[model samples]
Target: MTNHFPLTAKRSLELLGLIAIFGVLYIAKDIIMPVLMAFFISIMLLPIYRFLRKKKVPESLSIILPIILVALFIALIVWFFSNQIGILVKDFPQIKSNVSQHINNLSDWISRITHYNDKEQKAFIQGKSDDLMNMGTKLAGGAALTLSGVFVFIGLLPIYIYLMLFYKDILLRFIFMWFKTDHHPKVKDAIYETESIIKSYLIGLLIQITYMTILLGGILMIIGIKHALLIGVIFAILNLIPYVGALIGNIIGVLLTLTSSQELWPVITVLGVIALVQFLDNNILMPRIVGSKVKINALFAILGVFIGGSVAGVSGMFLALPIIAVLKIIFDRTEMFKQWGVLLGDERPAKSPMGFASFRKKKPVAVKSGTEKEE
Candidate 1:
């Protein structure tokens, strides 16, 4: 007779395995993050790479060309930001005056609402400012270390991308070799699906960023909001962080508006514009562009973002969805982990397990005359 481990044992083993995986990821994040990022970028660039190859371009040249194009694109963005920021910096005195005016306004409002007078509010602000100054000092001390790490990440990224593309076949073979011959088809399907999903998602994000910047910045500029382009760029980038990002973008938009202008209407206008753009982007743009192939429910998506941030900071947070999507693809293909794939998806059932109909599919809860208990 054959014997199997109990369900409890299986669950414990799975839990332990997950803990071990995340532990390793956190410990070796510096080494893993760049490679992971490169892998995704390479996947996104695969079509370009293949097209070059089909045109009889040298493999080395094809790889290098894509990397160079990406570098140029990044440099262009950096230049634009620097130029815009220099203009913003030139208006610092005006911004400071506006900020002070806003602070006085706030103090007056607070004094009217509470018992705190202007002196008390100023004292409180001074104390907090000192605390911030000290915190800034500490951050300045660590800035060099952070800067060096960023350099290292950037330096290693292209090399990793190039090598991954060069050795793509070997990687495929390695993956296929791990599974039995019978499972190769499933593995290939998963690989192809992951590639499709990653490519679509990343490209869609680029498109979304472009339009968001244009829509937000253009509207704000049309309304004569100062630093409109800067606000648009900041929000467009931050909006990549999923649900949490849009909220942060709104806060940032309002703060930028307030800092640059002494008018309350601009602040309100900024908020309204941000809200409208976000609504349109979320409802109309993202769905059609990114598609519903990898539908992660909100609960798990938020948890993934938090867990990823804990494990690998901002890069982790940004990568959370695609990583989860890849995992979901794998899990859905595997019999043992198919339930997990379902858990990660956004599909709604017709009814709940306790007999409550799904909101999406409401049904009349008819009661039998005698046999069925209302309880």
Candidate 2:
């Protein structure tokens, strides 16, 4: 006799529904990116809003303060860049000459070490010189495009931030409304945990970046490195990318240092300083700050960074940990997703003890001199 287990129409429809949902998300990618960005930014700023509210400040005032501060900060950065442009423009010729001289010294050193003749060395350097020039031009163009995009986005940002800050409660209520009324408590708990995780991650990230910037800048300055401020700022920003970021920063710093001076010791000293700072960051600062909040394993954290970077670039990488934390939070609260919670969570929930009979049956202890022991 043959037996058949037929697929029901309901099961077919359920599979179709899942596909449709994913299709919709794929189509809405552009819209989702901006909303996600605004949401994370709001999450990061929520603590300040809560603090103000706790101090008896009006919601409007609390919201307005952070928005204004953000605007002022952007304006300050713009002003600084505008002022620097003039000096940079005036010194461009001298800067180019200095750079060219450094490049020549570096090429000569490489040629001597590699046994490349003058013609071969010059040919190699010329090709690199062209590549460098093209890269600089491309960088400049990209920066211009980014600046333009920022200006366009700036107009929409205030409104977006305000709505997020003001109607946060209503928005949250709408999300919770999807679940059954009895599940509301669990939903709220999940939301709260997720918010706490995002907030903690952002605060920790800010502290880490600021500390890294200061430490890096001071070290570079002490070593009398030119463009120390620029290099430090670059390194600090790159540090946001997680594990590989510091290494990239160091490589860039060393290359730039090599270009600036023929002295090997200066480059070695710079590397040493960066290594020390990285050691401190990884061992002391990261553990105290980010590690607790982002309880994911190193493998998952790295995977998260790569996936985020692939999807949203640098912004995504920076947002990845909090995103994973939020997922873990939700998983922990939802009964159906408890298994996922176990997978994502760093801390394993302790197992309850089995009944004495069951435990003894499984163990099959040996008795010796009135003492029982498991073999």
Candidate 3:
């Protein structure tokens, strides 16, 4: 009476479907990445677009206005960083001198430890010069790819965003049509929750970047660190990537401090400042601002970042968490996929995980690298 073949076939199809999805993502990343980025930007701008529509603004104006606002905000950030970079350029000679001194000191220390005299060191480097040249050539090609990718992203982004905004109603109708009439309520809820999660996560990230820049930069300024603002801004932006981003930020901060200053105290101070700031961010700010709406566990979050990076580089990493969150939302709302949602989410209550909506926010969960109150 029990026919196991049907069940096995169903599972096989599901596994194949997942593989095909990933294969497509990898193969068509050039187009997929830009469209995905545009989608997120559109979702983030949805509230502003809706508000303008309510005021009886023209359809085109409502969309154009929000995009312009986003452009202006980005331009402001670019302008500020340009000035900071100019300041650093003016102090370049001093920075170069300090960097050279540190490099010589490091070389000497390495030579002493490894028992490689100056002549041996020179020979070792000379022997590797050919390999280094080949590596440099490869890097140059990669750089070309990167530059072209940037232009493609800039060109396609506005177009994709406009289309997404213009066809928003059509997309909604398609979503509705994909489900039965009886599931309309669930589909609507999934859409609403997805929008809310994307909005909250993005807005929270902006807040996090702002305050991190202030606190981290301000502390470094007080400590007389050169390029304090530069280091702070770089770290703050990179910190948006989650988990591994902080580590990268830390290394960059330390590297900048070492190159800019002769004294070691500034390096120590920079590390300490970063640690304290990260603590404040992880424990205090994220929970209130982002909440726990997405609820993705740490393992998948970090894996998604790395996988996205491997697939599409920086943009992929930036888009990873939010994309995963949106997928989780859809999965959670469907009966056949709810178990996958549970695996994606944190191990918490079956009824409902405590979030900002719960009124009584639960204590932050301890993760391997740091604690995150928000998903």
Candidate 4:
């Protein structure tokens, strides 16, 4: 009994330590989130950084080159969205008319289906107008805060990336120093696997974004949907965040369709198209591209997304999967945490059905126990 006491105490302490770590993560999210983002970004940019270094580019220039390219890519997306917004503004009058017509159509349907007349509906909405106004004011304030945070996050991100890149060797040495000389090989293997998985996942996502945007935007354009390209690009990017982002994308696509079209069919069409795209992405595309690389179960992925969002908003949600993957790698390599790695892993496989004929053939025959023993 005494032999087990120390082991139990150790595990209890470990649990409390883990709880403390998460608490600190939640409390210090403002700083930690940006650093984590930079870490992941640096990992993704490592190949490019190495390529440039191989060409004998200066260290600082190699680091700066990828950041500049990323910045330009972001700027291009912003320019595209700004252009789309301008088009939306130009067509606002028509949109307003269509919305008004839709509202009237809705009211007529309501009157036909229920006892609530148009006057009662108007009165009901009028009563909530002040509440809606207050909600809008709160939303605007939140938006301002979010915008400021985004700018600060963006500013810190590149500097953090550069510093991480600059100290890569030191960091590698520090990691090695944590373990004994005999364990270096295992540590190196873990690091190599972690890097490979993250690289594959990130590259897969980039390809997903490109192909999804083209497929969705092209289809919508063929079907005569306005702002089809914008919706496609927006949804494709948002869908990268997993479950929550896809829901938000659906809402945005439907709202855009509603505002732009007088007929109800386009809204339904947009919803259907988004659903089909999501199905294809999840079952066919993701398996082929990401394909058991991260090996995260659907349950943990969804929970991580929600928990991460609660802790650190959008960045947290976006970082959740890769971070979990990295953690699993570390855990699987460590003797103490291999059980946790197993718990986090996707280990299930399809089972074949039982064959009745085989079972019948293998069935035991009845015999007298004494006679069989004598024989």
**How close is every model to the real structure, measured as TM-score?**
0.93, 0.77, 0.88, 0.89
Candidate 2: deviation at residue 59, Å? 2.8
Q: In model 3, how large is the Cα lDDT of residue 334?
A: 72
- lDDT (0 to 1) per candidate: 0.89, 0.73, 0.86, 0.86
Stretches > 4 Å off in candidate 3: 111-114, 122-134, 348-375
Q: Candidate 3 lDDT, tens digit per residue, 1-375?
A: 269988678778878998898899999999899999999999999989999999999999999998888878878888988998798788889889998788678779888789778787767767798889999998998898888988888778878888899999999999999989999999999899899999999988999999999999999999788889888899999999969899999999998898788778899999999999999998898888898887899999999999999989899999999999998988778766666676788765422345434422333333333343444
lDDT of 2 at 63: 93
Candidate 3: which pairs clash?
none
Candidate closest to the true structure, highest lDDT: 1
- After superposing candidate 2 on the true structure, give the runs of residues whose Cα lies further than 4 Å from its correct spot: 1-30, 54-56, 77-115, 131-145, 346-375
Task: Quote the lDDT for 148 in model 1.
Answer: 100
Sorted by TM-score, highest first, which candidate order results? 1, 4, 3, 2
Q: Please give, for residues 24-106, the per-residue lDDT of candidate 1 as tens digits.
A: 99999999999999999999999999999999999999999999988898888889999988987998999999999999999
Model 1 residue runs over 4 Å out of place are 1-4, 354-375
Candidate 4 per-residue lDDT, tens place, 1-375, comes to 999999799789879998997899899999999999888888889999999999999999999999998789878998999999999999999999988888889889999999999999888877798789999998998898889989999999889999999999999999999999999999999999998999889889889999889988888889999899988999999988978889998899988998999998988888888888888988898889988889887889999899899999888898899999999999888877776675677753122114234322222223233223422
- In candidate 4, stretches whose alpha carbon ends up further than 4 angstroms from where it belongs are 1-3, 349-375
Report clash pairs, candidate 2: none
Evaluated with TM-score, which candidate comes out highest?
A: 1
